[model samples]
Target: MSARRPYTVRFRTPDNNTLENCFYATDAFQARLLAMEFNRYIKDHPNRIDKIFSAAQR
Candidate 1:
């Protein structure tokens, strides 16, 4: 296996706050998935605006 590098996933939260999350993955696909999941969680809750912030998943 290859070493996992720290990947950054940046997106605007539902509160209009730009957030950057660091993930360790071998490729961008995995990093994207992580970001998508996080974005999904941020959307699923209440009292927040839900929007697609991912490039592919959006």
Candidate 2:
């Protein structure tokens, strides 16, 4: 596996609230990918999450 670094993931919830969590990734691309995966997970569950974004995206 590639070496990973700490990244912060910020996402909005279905309730219109925001949440953040730390994730590991080899690079920004991978980090966003991981965030998208997590976003999918949240979407699959009710009131879980609404959006997935990288703190560094902006």
Scored by TM-score, the top model is 1
TM-score of each: 0.55, 0.52
Can you write out model 2's per-residue Cα lDDT over 1-58, one digit (the tens) per residue? 8777777766566666778666788775566666667667544552343333444653
State, as a TM-score between 0 and 1, how close model 2 is to the true structure: 0.52
| lDDT per residue (tens digit) for residues 1-58 in model 1 | 9777777666665567866666677776676666667667534642343232334343
RMSD of 1: 6.9
* Clash count of each predicted structure: 0, 0
Judged by whole-model lDDT over C-alpha atoms, candidate 1 comes out at: 0.58
Worst lDDT run of 10 residues, candidate 2, spans 46-55
The C-alpha RMSD in Å for every predicted model, in order, reads 6.9, 4.8
lDDT per prediction?
0.58, 0.61
Weakest lDDT window of 10 consecutive positions for candidate 1? 45-54
